[model samples]
Target chain A: DTAVSQTPKYLVTQMGNDKSIKCEQNLGHDTMYWYKQDSKKFLKIMFSYNNKELIINETVPNRFSPKSPDKAHLNLHINSLELGDSAVYFCASSQGTGPLGYEQYFGPGTRLTVT
Target chain B: SQQGEEDPQALSIQEGENATMNCSYKTSINNLQWYRQNSGRGLVHLILIRSNEREKHSGRLRVTLDTSKKSSSLLITASRAADTASYFCARRNAGGTSYGKLTFGQGTILTVHP
Candidate 1:
């Protein structure tokens, strides 16, 4: 069974368009996260939600928003997609929000290409 | 800001040889973890060492931590071609407000040639 999964594995869109990526986890974890990997291969955390509550919000632009419908699902929506928005986005989940929660299971990642 | 920086950004080794990667972090951490990522894939957790622990081993992987120096090392013995991937070191911040947030390092790309 896949513990974590993401939909729309590859997305190619033009500038000024809007897109959304969905993530789901079956690991019975309470926390979910979104990370962005740029062309330079730099992985950075964008947002984190615990039990459907926003917990950590990084220095991301206002165009990006994350929504969690439940404890098991977190989705990312990007508006006015720019060329710089083209990057791989990974969704992760953990059991809790503590030190033991450090071990996160990541999905295969959704690659977004903006033209 | 990125908290960890991995040394030797890329490495190429022959099959059956051992590979080592180093990581250094800037702040206090509750624990440090190692993850491996195949091309165009998400990261997979390898191992984690707590602030109180010094060293640990799992299968052919060995991890050593130096809290004083704020650095760590990951060693893979008898690496196979399948071991070729990007290795990253991540840290769980010791701050109370930063729950479940992992700051990842710039990864080390390893290529094991068969």
Candidate 2:
């Protein structure tokens, strides 16, 4: 069984359009995160949620928003998508907060293409 | 912004050879983690070494951390063709409210020839 899953593995949309990617984790993890991998393959954290509460918000644009309905789900919504948004979006989950020894498990990722 | 920077952005090795990747980060950290990502796939957790720890091992994978240098190294022994992938090092920022959040470095792509 897949531990972390994201819906619409491939998303192709035009500029000025809004889109949303859904992510769900069944590991009963308390923390979930959204990461963006650029063309150069640099992965950066965009947002994080713990137990349906927003915990970390990077310097991402206001056009991008993350919502967590519950501890098991975190969704990302992008408004007015731009060509620069073309990249891979990954969803990950971990067992606890703080550093220590928690390991993150990533999903298959959603390839977003903006034209 | 990227917190960690990995050396030798790309590596090519023959099967049975050992591969080593180095990661250096700025500022202190609670832990350092290594992950592997196959092309077009999500990342897979390889191993994590805490700040207090000096060395750790998992199977053919060995990880070493040096807090004094704020760097870490991952060594893969007996690398196989299947070991071809991008390896990334992520560090949990030490201070501020950003604890537990991981900042990843530019990955090192390793190609193991059969």
Candidate 3:
């Protein structure tokens, strides 16, 4: 069984198309996050959700939105995608906020390709 | 966001040799974590060392943390081809505002010759 999973491991679409990626974690986590990894293998945080509330959004474009219906699922939806949007998007989850102990569980990133 | 840097961007060693990768961060952190990413795959959590703790070990892996230096290091003993992958260190800041968000380093690519 996968601890964290994402649908459509690879997505290819035209520059103007809209697309979405889904993520779920069976580990019973309380927090979920979205990160984008560029071509240079640089991963940066895009969004973070904790207990169904948006907590952190790091200067991500308005075209990209993240939704967390429940603690176990977080989805990313992009409107009017662009070539620059082509990157591997990763979903991660953690049991709770940490100072003593906590580590994240990551999904098998969705590789998005914008033509 | 960029937390800091990982030195020796690339590392190479023989199957039986040991491999070491170092990471440094800028601000204070509650804990430091190490992750491994194989080619075309997701990242896997390897180990974590808290700011208060100095060293931790799991099987063949050893992680050392130095809060004073704002640095951490991962050591793989008796490495194998299976250990060849990109290793990244992430910082988990302390406080409620962190929201469990991790700031990851650039990463170190390790290649173990079989």
Candidate 4:
């Protein structure tokens, strides 16, 4: 079984479209994170949720929203997508918040392209 | 909001050779982690070295952390062509709102030729 998985590994959409990416982890983790990798391959944290509670939110655009209905799942929704939104999005998870929680498990990324 | 700065940015080596990548940060950290990302794939955790720990080894991967210099390094012994990938180091602040958050480095692209 996959420890972490993301649906629709590749997504292509047009500008102004709305889309969502779903993430799930079967590792019984309490914390999950979302990261975006730009064309330059620079990875940055977009949001983090611990026990379904938002903990950290980077300076992302208002159009981007993260929702965690449960500790095992985190989803990203983008409204009115722009061409600049084309990049690889990754979902990650950890045991929880603490010193021993630094190690993270990542799922296969979702390659999103806004045409 | 501190990010790790990886050195060389890119590296190339032959099979059986060793590859080393360095990461330097601007602030103190509770722990440092190394992750490897294959082309068009998600990142996989490799090693984690805490502030209290100087060095750690797993399989052929060795990681060293130097808090005084705010830097850490990853060394892969006997590299193989399959080891070609991008490596990144992430740092966690000791205490702050971003405690559980990880600040990643730009990454080091390593090419190992057979």
Q: Pick the candidate with the highest DockQ.
A: 2
Candidate 2 per-residue C-alpha lDDT over A17-104 given as tens digits, one digit per residue, 9 for 90 to 100: 9999999999999999999999999999999998898999989999999999999999999999999999999999999877585999
- DockQ, Cα level, model 4: 0.72
Q: How do all the candidates rank in terms of TM-score, highest first?
A: 2, 1, 4, 3
What docking grade applies to model 3? medium
Q: After superposition, how far is residue A11 of candidate 4 from its true place, in Å?
A: 0.9
**C-alpha RMSD for every candidate:** 1.0, 1.0, 1.2, 1.2
TM-score, chain B, each candidate: 0.96, 0.96, 0.96, 0.96
- Native contact recovery (fnat) for each candidate is 0.79, 0.81, 0.74, 0.66
lDDT of residue B101 for candidate 1: 89
Model 3 lDDT tens row, A1-115: 8599999899999999999999999999999999999987888899999899998899999999999999999999999999999999999998887566588888999999999
Clashing pairs in 1: none
| Tens digits of per-residue lDDT for model 2, B48-112 | 99999999999999999999998999999999999999999999877778736998999899999
Candidate 3 retains true contacts at a fraction of 0.74
Candidate 2 clash total?
0
Candidate 4 off by > 4 Å: none
Residue-level lDDT tens digits of model 3 in B1-114: 356999789999999999999999888888999999998888999998888899999999999999988889999999999999999999987766777788899999999999
TM-score of each: 0.97, 0.98, 0.97, 0.97
In model 2, which regions exceed 4 Å deviation?
A: none
Candidate 4 residue pairs in clash (backbone atoms < 3 Å)? none
